[model samples]
Target: MKNYFWNMLINIKNGQMAKKSVIIGPRKNICESFLKILWNEGFISGYKISPQNTRNLEIFLAYTKNGKPVINSLKFLSKPSQRIYYSSKQIWKIDSSKTFIIFSTNLGLKSITECKKNKIGGEPLIVIN
Candidate 1:
């Protein structure tokens, strides 16, 4: 499924800038629904990351239909300080003018907090279940 998603993103990147933000969280029914929502909204260049693989931190950078940078998702290994560090790095890679909305479960709260503390600019819309 991961490979499939990667391929789909690659294809979507061939066109213009996609107005989308990266989503990271546990792999659940809601997460899939979120992807569908983005797709239907013309936010096709995106990526998903499961909690189990958060430590590795995979980043997916795609362009919008107009050639703007749209980072869909970034996966980072969960650790005491890694989230803040990775968030900074990810934020640096993209255009600061572009806004990013992150979706995650409660498990990501700590990381989200770290991002806020560092002023990474990623507005996290956490979903609690």
Candidate 2:
């Protein structure tokens, strides 16, 4: 099956490029968790379930004062065919200060920092810088 979270990422990217204030996507637990991560990391202003249609998600894009998108780059680590999973020990090898990696764990999606702090790891989903 296609990854809806990846499509949501693309929508956010496209929305930023097009200077769109908001991007709409299907409401999904995973996607909502990812959006929450983005918001916590300051990539997006925020997101909410659409009032008109509860099944839709409305994500507010964030931009800089000079009209530049907050999210400048994105890297997808896991694909449907080949998945990437990292243990807490292996996750400690990545030393990136400018980027954050999202990992899907049993408790839901967690960032690299959270994984490291909690001594847990999961599939490396995407890296945003």
Q: Which has the greatest TM-score?
A: 2
RMSD of each: 11.6, 1.3
lDDT of 2: 0.88
Clashes of 2: 0
Q: Which residue ranges in model 1 land beyond 4 Å of their true spot?
A: 17-35, 40-98, 101-129
TM-score of every model? 0.26, 0.94
Residue-level lDDT tens digits of model 2 in 45-72: 9988899999999899999999999988
Candidate 1 shows a clash count of 13
Ten contiguous residues minimizing lDDT sum, candidate 2: 1-10
After TM-score superposition, the amount by which residue 65's alpha carbon in candidate 1 deviates from its true location, in angstroms, is: 12
* Candidate 1: C-alpha lDDT: 0.40
lDDT of 2 at 70: 93
TM-score of 2: 0.94
All candidates' lDDT scores? 0.40, 0.88
TM-score, prediction 1: 0.26
Tens-digit lDDT track of model 1 for 32-55:
454554444344544556456853
Candidate 1, residue 69: lDDT: 53
